[model samples]
Target: MTKMTFRKLLAATALTGITATAVVAEEVDYGKFDGYTLRVKLIGGAQYEPLYARIAEWEAMTGATVDVLSRKNHFELDREIKQDIAAGTLDWCVGSNHTSFAPQYGSIYIDLNGVIADATLAEFQSLALENSTVDGRLVQLPRHSDISNLYYIKSLFEDADNQAKFEAEYGYALTPPETWDQVKDQAMFFADAPTFYGTQFVGKDEAITGRFYELLIANGGALFDDDWNPTFNSAAGVEAVNFFKDLYEAQAVPAGSLNYLWDDTGLGFASGTVALNLDWAGWASFFNDPENSKIAGDIGLVRAPKGSAGIRTGWSGSHSFSITETCDNQAAAASFVTFLTSHESQMVEATAGLLPTRAAVWDDAKAQFTADGNNFLVEVFETYAVSMSEDAFTPPLITPWIEVSNEIWPQLQAAILGEKTPQEALDEAADAARIVMEDAGYL
Candidate 1:
């Protein structure tokens, strides 16, 4: 038999630590569970691993062992969980979940409402809690929320020669973009391509699809009608698609952007090869660190730009934990999840630049940053807080979202690469999305 130790388990699972005293001091007593091993599958990445470190503290407190069953990225973990469902091998008690992926799991996860203390549930942002609930059941406890904002190289905008040339060409002073039209004009004005491009985007998979979806919404288009039929092939949709097409045609963004993911876009901006990037709050720390970014101290940010309809693009979601229905120790699993999302644990994550789900953590984290004299993160948290409360919105809570996204993004790529026209690509994607809705019984 393989023996498990806390270090071995954490390294194998790529998990991180949390603030044990803070959570334990506030929660229902975690009674002793000597020798009980709670198994879990978690999403793994550098930004996410720090919170996992606190599991050892939980083990020490409750005398329960945490056996991490698997550690993979969200996309890979989604596939693994689906396979586990089909195979009926959901032996793990807790799994990482997302708002966009939760509906597809149906009743696999236990309803967390009664399991978690009411006060604890009330502590989370109401919108975060609402998004974590599906079919009137709280299936998951949110860890952190996400929304995109613009990041740019401050030096470029401050360059006097570039500023004069930009104002002359676009009839506006050079500054951080305030609208999608300005983004386009500035991207064209700043771009040199190959060596350096004005901007880039997540080009394929759900990344690009999510980008298009939010832009479509901001452009006053809806993805579907009230009955769930696809309606995103409208004039507004055309305008959204045209935005990408124009950027690509002008070569203002990277040539390989269609193949890029979050890491690619994040690293591209850090490399100082891209002047502007639209990304989530998760990358805020990494983007400003001198060790990781070429333009470290020179970075600037603003809320995501507005579309023709005058609304800001604010595609959003949250990372969360769910207890599986098949678990033998539902109570223990619930306790573990609650402990992880507690105020102190959330502060640990928020300190590392992750956006916390708890409302108070926002104030506390901002205060901590301010006290530390970290003005960059201070502005970051403030900007994101406003967006989270007022501007953020999630994709339609449906099981077929990923499948539909998978079908739509490739068509977007073809159009951006000039292999098809914008209208043709959206028409094809709408047809595919129709089939997905039909099979999901929404037709």
Candidate 2:
């Protein structure tokens, strides 16, 4: 299907509401704010927009109007927020936030500790709430949490002819890859290039840098030492960089991968050309929908694979809502955020395949899927829950994380595209990361 039609279908599928009784049994008492306008700046995207449609419910319940002042992608929104800080234009009461992006805003957002009820806070997963904290302050209410797992074409492993050829060449039985080494071997084995690639990766900006960071962790290396000194130029780091370089050198991944991002990788997998893709739970419904994917019935999933150090690569973050400290209506803002993250709202998102931050929603959504006979999504939730609970880790919650990412990814592209050896590239990246750490007063 065309991207436009696919998005429309997703919007329709996502906006289907559950019963009001299923949402909240005890009504929220948001006093009265008849003439008040609760201004918000939310992330606008196909997956995120449907949830905004429910803002009307919040307005109606509390006699307040929600004025969405700005709607942009995260990067654009981040820039706008920076400008807002610099110009003293944070007039909007609430804004979209991420765990990685929250620390940079300093004291602009309110500490949501006592604003949201203890019961509500207790309902969310502890790990997600912990990630949302900055300087011991709970600054954002997590909307959803994300970490990736591998998706591949099941037929590639099950095909007798392909299996026989793979076994003959590699001297091992072909199955879903359990390690990055096996992933590489399988990718190379399945590759045909141009017409079909073995795999693809997010290749620029924080996307590539985040991918590298997770791999570095999985290989027993880290971005910084206890002193906050850059330390990712180690042997483990070299192994991590070479993984991407080797794939590019063999033409196992696409030539245009350096220009690709998450959407590119998702659509590539859905097109049935890529042999393997590591992506978030958000794409599970899309990847298995016959209307949107050529590989709909043939797809297979496995938990994210391990690296040389035997740790699973689970770089995670949460999309969240934060109430600004400057807001005149903290109660109304809290009400809106609470409603958006309610069990019903989360169920709406979960039905469309977005992972939930609320623990109860996990079982409720899975049971709903099972009852509906959506075995694909059933497996998707079960697999992702383990990763979200035990395997997931976030980058150090520091302001310069994005700045460090900016310096690292361009050099990463240069290395992957053959302009530098993996060691040389990582050394350069380490030096640049040191400069960032120093500038942030962490040195």
- Top candidate, metric lDDT: 2
Spell out the clash pairs found in candidate 1.
Answer: 16-49, 16-50, 16-51, 16-52, 16-53, 17-50, 17-53, 17-54, 18-54, 203-258
lDDT of each: 0.87, 0.88
| True-structure lDDT of candidate 2 | 0.88
Candidate 2, 370-443: lDDT as tens digits: 99999999999989987786568788889898999888899899888889988898899889999888989988
How close is every model to the real structure, measured as TM-score? 0.93, 0.93
Per-residue error (Å), model 1, residue 443: 1.3
Shift of residue 168 alpha carbon in model 2, Å: 2.0
- lDDT tens digits by residue: candidate 1, 176-286: 999998998888888998899988899988889899999998898988888988888888888988898898889999988888999899999999998888899989899
**Cα lDDT, model 1, residue 110:** 90
- What value does the lDDT take at residue 85 in candidate 2? 100
